[model samples]
Target: MKVSPDGQPTADVIARVKDIPLYREAVARGHFPVLEKAEIARGFPDNWMTPALAAALDAGEAEFVLSTGTNHARMQLIRPPYFLLKSYYRLWSTHPDIKETWEAGCRRVSLTTVLATEHVARVNAKKRGEEPRPDPRPADRRLDARTFYLNTRLDPALWERADVERMLAEMAEARQAHPQGWYHLDCSGYHLAHLLQKINKWGLWDAFSPPASIIHAYEFTPVNVRRYLQQHFACPIIDLFGSTELGYLFYSDRRGRYHPYLEDMSVELAPVTEGSGLFHLIVTSVRNPHMPLVRYRSGDCARTLDGTPDPAKIKQFSGREKELLESPSGPVAQGDLDALVGSVSPHVFVHQLRVLSPAEAVLAYTTFDGRPLAPRQVAALGHGVRELTGRRCVLDHRDHIAIGKSGKYAWLARDGK
Candidate 1:
């Protein structure tokens, strides 16, 4: 069946869905329902396995992989090797703001979770029996000839002076390796912020090399973190929104305006709750030929500039659907609270909203400089929280916040959970 310019099939795409065992029964029932994770995991690869797919696997044309489990439990998936990296490179080479750097053959230095770095090392090793040798050298963590990994710890908040120094030295080496002495930085925005804080504390600016361009595609970066990066780096800071299952679908420009990159995909947004601005992202894509997703609920949420379903107007990829919270006014998303906090103070780095009771909550936060927020800023934050959640909020300051077991940070939690 031929697909339209917008990715909608002119004929029934269900024709293809019916071929897959997983959706055969649903198609036979004459009802094409939105696919969820539980249903996909019901029969494992047997449901999706075909003679041709098995042949592809045997020939090493496709492989099994697991999702990062950032927002939920890990999900098993099948795709061609380097599926995500190809998607990333396609965007980087064509994005108006970053194409010049990409075409220049710039080196990439990734600084994100240690889990991500370790995953790269494991994949590169190609052996699963024993753990890869612990090597602090960049060559051991190199993903490819053009890309290298930097961070080796689970949490950025716990990075010591030696950690900072080592990362800076490795980054300098990466920059020097480039013919132009410029390298591209790929990172989680939170990790970059932590690095910047440590660099400032130790006055290590000379040891670090500013990238020609930067992309933060790992997680939901708070608004303040983006602004903080702007103050330190003159390069373009782009935001990419996508997942492991689906390659990157959209990316932002230097001005923070998002543009769709759905070459073989389409997206629809459903309201998280009636009359609420937040929306759940439902995607249908043939990007991954091994496991084509049909109207898959991606478990991610977003918000539109005008609170409408226009994909072009998608202003923010807010947070995960599982992490959403309830309030008297409406549902509260991670981005909703992040915007409120950013407005109160740019000094706030990491934060978590702990719901104490139906009528009370606490906003715990840590500053960039290990100092508490001003009294006025704290009071403003409390007022803002109360207005947003219909609960009295107590502001608490701390020197550190913990990373999650998944190697990401949680923006909202309840009762120390």
Candidate 2:
């Protein structure tokens, strides 16, 4: 458990790294460097893909697959997709209260939370009359929840008539795929919250059956939006924290507590500073035999146990490291802001805290149309920020939170890195 300056790999990580052809020489040198995404991309198929691995992917195996991209732009990884899906399923199957609805079956439906940026890029390229490369064989053929909603993007008028009709149609299709009332809702929380809010607004609650479980990934879950889902659905709402490169690593429980579920992987928290308790999650996952990420910097942050990086005691996975804000007290993470807002009222759907300077900060946020944060709630938020970061902050109420062109939201957007 002792950390080296370079974060030494354990016997397991070393053994796995040695198995990869690319890392064989580095392993022989008796000192392995961290596996970086940029380094991995220098020569993609040649860097990590062996003839056997490439052939397997070419042959179309469900276990070995490709991804579009995640919140982080444009980086693709080839790994087992369903491997991540089943991890959540198994976690749900083992949980006590959380498993009540989903225990009967693993039936599920997926609603994509992100726009297919890659597809849009290709469409734009075609408009300019440039020949875009064809999608790799078999990789493009695998179908899952994302297949249904890749082309659409969310916006202010996301649930409008035409949109509502389309959503209802998609829901009907998903329902037909799973007739049982109790099922898992694999979706983006933002999309689901908006859909549920619209359903309530249009009085369409009875039109569709409630899902037994709701699993939201792809983006940071806002407290207010989560509250919206909790209020509407009787099922347990869980957050699966992971990326395409690394499968499901941790998930949130009903109590908002994060529990570790590593699959042939080990995680270490390397402190961002001396004793910040916030550390970079350096993961060594050999689960992907082709690309065994050893001491890979995930660019994600978390508060660990007892000011130490105890894998089992990960308090929360804040957003990306570059997205974190510098404050007078210390660095403020997305989870830190989430706590400040969530405590006051979980209904505060979208919040963006901009650090104007060391002395001032502005929190722009919105809630459901009818419910507003009370004066006390506003005061509590300001008080919490002041206590947490020693900043003179105030809540700037917003009518609506705008989605980016990518149909994604930024919980933390700063002036500079």
lDDT of each: 0.87, 0.68
- Name the regions of candidate 1 deviating beyond 4 angstroms: 1-12, 127-130
- Please give each candidate's TM-score: 0.95, 0.81
lDDT per residue (tens digit) for residues 1-417 in model 1: 233454343345666556789877776776556789987788889888977789989999999999988788888999999899899999999999999989999988999988888887777666545567676456668888888899889999889999999999888887888889889999999999999988888899889889999999999999989999999999999999999999999999999999989886878888889899889998888788888887789999999999998788999999998888888888899999999999999999999999988999999999877899989999999999999999999999988889987679989888856
TM-score winner among the candidates?
A: 1
Clash total of candidate 1: 0
Q: How far is candidate 1 from the true structure (C-alpha RMSD, Å)?
A: 2.1
Alpha carbon lDDT of residue 246, candidate 2?
77
Candidate 1, residue 405: the lDDT equals 73
Cα-based lDDT at residue 101, candidate 1: 87
* Candidate 2 positional error at 306, Å: 3.9
Q: How far in Å is the alpha carbon of 360 misplaced in model 2?
A: 2.7
**How close to the true structure is residue 388 of candidate 2, measured as C-alpha lDDT?**
79
Give model 2 RMSD, 1 decimal: 5.2
